[model samples]
Target: MSTTTGLWLFRRLWKPAEGTPVKAVVVFLHGYGEYIDRYDAAASVFARSGIVFWGFDFEGHGRSDGERGFVTEAGFDAFTDDAEQALRLAARQFPGLPIFVMGHSLGGLVAVRLGARLAKAAEAVDAEAGAPLFGRIKGFLLSAPAIEVDPAVAQPHLVFIARVLGSCMPRIRLGGIPAGDLSNNATVNDHYSRDSMNNTRPFAARFASGVLAATEAVPGIAADFTWPLLGMQDEGDKTTVPGACERFVHTCGSPDAAFKLLRGRKHELFMADGYEDLITGTIMPWIEERCETAEPEAGGAAAAEAGLARDGMSGDRDDEAEPTDVDAVKTTTSEEPVLGAAV
Candidate 1:
């Protein structure tokens, strides 16, 4: 456990098997209303592969200290600040190793923003003293980022009202996310519904509004992404919009980015049945390929261009139009309680 930014964050570090030299470190950011322990299975996969894995509960969720589903001030900024702290912790704990940041759902938004921020910070430092500040970060992996929430849950009228109320009574709690919308896997859904540490409380008005604003800011940030990125989203997901992922992949500035649209998966991809092997077979190889190489491929730009051409998006950099009102969705919170759920 570590305390920072006015909260006590519970952290778990998974090391490689005995005698294995850690080749890289992965800092994981879990989804909203969820905790670190839920990712133990995923973390173990990295551990077995000679990688170090670390994850923490967000300040207001899981074992972390804060008002449930609420950010005291700037919502996205606060979350990113905590994420940066986690990255710094990883750097300090495993110096001289490449670090990869992975985020799922709400955590995905944080990871994407953090990658851009780190790239920008490195650029600034290089310009001044020809040195990089966060040169260790190799890439980012985003799973079903909460760029746009389910439209059914975030009605336009409700969003408008929430924004107004956020400016006034920012602390007022509103309804939370619907559990049924999380995944189609019965076991995973059952576990999520029963987890006590899983926060199903209504979100504070300010927090909800802040998330909406952050989601809207993704396109603007995509133009600054400089690291390798891999984004995966479930086509059948009802928790987040798949089109948002498509837009981000097309507009992202990285020449070494790829997007995978899973046909029948759900919001919580890691929790879905038979996903453990899927992650190991697909996601692990992607991360390993990058980790084994010090620099991005020289043909990354050409490859990205080829991808754009194949998608009929050549020279279409300006296609990042904001989604319509019906598509403007933001995640919500609920107040259901279950025993043995808190991490």
Candidate 2:
């Protein structure tokens, strides 16, 4: 998509299988330094299960335009702009389908902000614009959300310095994500390492700062969240702290919010070993529960117009799907492995 700023964003979409009725529209947001392609298997599973999955590479990640691993100096808004653009795109492509936003790691944090944005839009601002979009968002799915960073890595002094440096040198490289540490599965790690489109370089200063800001602010804003949310994180997830997610779910005012700890798993919940169990055991059922909701009022009339104006985003609709369950889901596990198949 080419945004109003004339930036190109790479996007990917998976439609429901032929002869399958569309049940829902899901917009997935990936974590830092990763792209949409990483979730191909999972997206395919959603499609097979009657979901219309849509996602895009953030401006700096994957095949999208921008500096590698860098959200420019725009900080967090850059990421949210892309996500909101994606929501508008999905709404238009699959009009009237209940919208569900899912995010992993930093993407999880973005989803939180996006969810609050939706609620605020529908209730506080233009109901014509926000309600048409917000009210349609029935639920949210989070995986190892980066709403908080592990205190071990984000020490007070380190965080303070990063925030300071970020203000002055937003593009300076701070750290690099070691792909091998992402998953227990070697193939998954190998694939990630092989993907040149990914941001293998050191993290950008401002991007790091933006993430830290979200960690502190998002949890505090949990009081404003008003949607069904199911969050999962592994105890071994060194990538994101479990306690942070736990605190957010508890602090969140939503009556339907719940947090689950996928014990014995690694950081990459979807790509880790035994991901199938995680899907069938937890993630899918949550998806099934809230996937149904009152349809969007505009039937995506506004979203369709938004889609036509897309400078960012990528691509779903349906009801009474034959139950998009994991047991019956046929996925490309041979290529990599499992939650890579579901969440």
Candidate 3:
């Protein structure tokens, strides 16, 4: 059973299905323009693991009070605050339970920053009271985080131009434009349109400002983060460039940061076929190990120890706990359509 509670004008929950215990909350963050409902299937998986799931609608997103597809400059910051409030409220509802934060795409970036902020805030409280401020989270899960701007195309100039132009014309409604303004393509997939969870309109001035703020802030989060972090990036990801994902894996400051490129998978790894099984069978087990057994290694411990280490990271062992050959996924050809399918 799951019960919903209101926090910051949004709904959150403690979902305990599939025999999950009363404790063990997993806070989920949906991607841009998307709502928590898209994660219903994922929540069920957590329930089966005896883990309660919690998630909410960002202000400009589902079920929250705000203009549809319109975001303000304080967008990301507000979302982060809402998430933190949800965590505190959840703690009150179910005390003494271990919590994990997981985010997808834009949400992934949010989780990384939020986790580090929580730690820092707690430190601030400890300095004054000589006691930890909040229950430390168990771990972090980032699936295809939208950390780096995609490099497949000439992005910097495009982004800069958009920012500059948007400043002059802040109220532009890009949703009706072909290829949705960002790509300028004609056949931008309909899934984005039908999935009301996503924000179909153009980025509001405030929201755009928040994105720049987030991008600038990512380095600080990466440098300060001290929790176990797992990143699952796709080799064939179309939304975020492979180059960016690779850089993020090494740049994230967590000693335990590890990203595996699912060979055949697309940007949305969670929604991909068979991924639920892979997560239940592989990733979750590793997260459990960190939560129950040891502190996550920082500065390239997990990757170096896993023997799959690459890109300037080096370690002597490959003790990553995985059934041999289970991590392999299929690869895609250059000719395949990148945006049409979900997976």
Candidate 4:
């Protein structure tokens, strides 16, 4: 886990018991040409609930180091400083517990910019208990959060000429995201084409302008997300943009934000096919009710059983106008969303 661009960053863990007393502490983030050991059975289902998973491998994905599926321009703006250096190394390797951040696709836009810079660095101070746990962060689940870019497959004129002509030859190459568009679940597209540290190719026009400036800065920081949020997507997710992650979890400013739905059109729902019902009925009851923050409503009852949009339920492919997701073997980037793979 060194860097200064000399690379190295590869860490991965999944301890469930070593001297028990675990109910929280996760920082998983795999997505966009994956790695972190393919979430080894979703970090053994949060180490069978004792929970203490981990992550890394984004300096150039998989076994870290750099080049495969590319990155640069500050290695794609240090994906939220390597997930806030794995959330301060999971609060110094799980000291006072209470941390949950389960990002998928583009690590759910860098865990919503490290949960809005640890919710404004836990509101300027008084993080209590020897201070600076950055307000202990007890939530954020998101799975398909590449926040906006499914214009029926990358069509804002191919995301405006792939970040305006790939920022003038910024490492060129281009094309990606078609391991069967990541999941119509043919055995998770044949185990993402027999793994091999899955990069699946073509990317690096400055990693497509760092995935279009880290997913176009997630809906302008969804009102500066105060933390505690749930996301889950795939209303025919052709990579990202499940109604731009249901309008950025209903424009989060978190009163415990929420939005759920991961129907058949999968985007690696931890290997699809009942994926243990998103882990024994929705992510261990939202990590055992946030192990301390007295959890209850990330829009409760599994987001009213995924009917979302509060209730007015809008579907018809969530049209607030459309046209994105692409790559005919090479069309710049944007989750390599091919036009036909409906999810």
- Write one digit per residue (lDDT tens) for candidate 3, span 81-124: 76676666655655556667888877887887787787677666
The C-alpha TM-scores of every prediction are 0.81, 0.81, 0.72, 0.32
Number of the predicted model whose TM-score against the real structure is largest: 2
The lDDT, on a scale of 0 to 1, for candidate 3 is 0.56
lDDT of each: 0.70, 0.70, 0.56, 0.65
Query: Which lDDT value does model 4 have at 338?
Result: 15
- TM-score between candidate 3 and the true structure: 0.72
Report how far off residue 309 is in candidate 4 (Å): 8.2
lDDT of 2 by residue, 1-343 (tens): 7654567887767776556767677888998888776776666667666667788778878777788866765677778877998898888767677888999988999999988877666677666666566757878888888887767788999998889889988888888766776766666777777766567889888888888897778866787887877777776676777566767776776667767666545567776666655654566666766655543222111112122343322211111112122211112325322123442
Q: After the best TM-score superposition of candidate 4, give how far the Cα of residue 343 lies from its true spot, in angstroms.
A: 32
Q: Which stretches of candidate 1 lie over 4 Å from their true place?
A: 1-4, 127-133, 150-156, 293-343
lDDT of 4 by residue, 21-108 (tens): 4667678888877776666665666665667677766777766677776666674667778788777876886666677888888888
Of candidates 3 and 2, the better by TM-score? 2
C-alpha RMSD values across all candidates: 14.4, 8.9, 13.1, 18.9
Instruction: Name the candidate, 1 or 2, with the larger TM-score value.
Output: 2
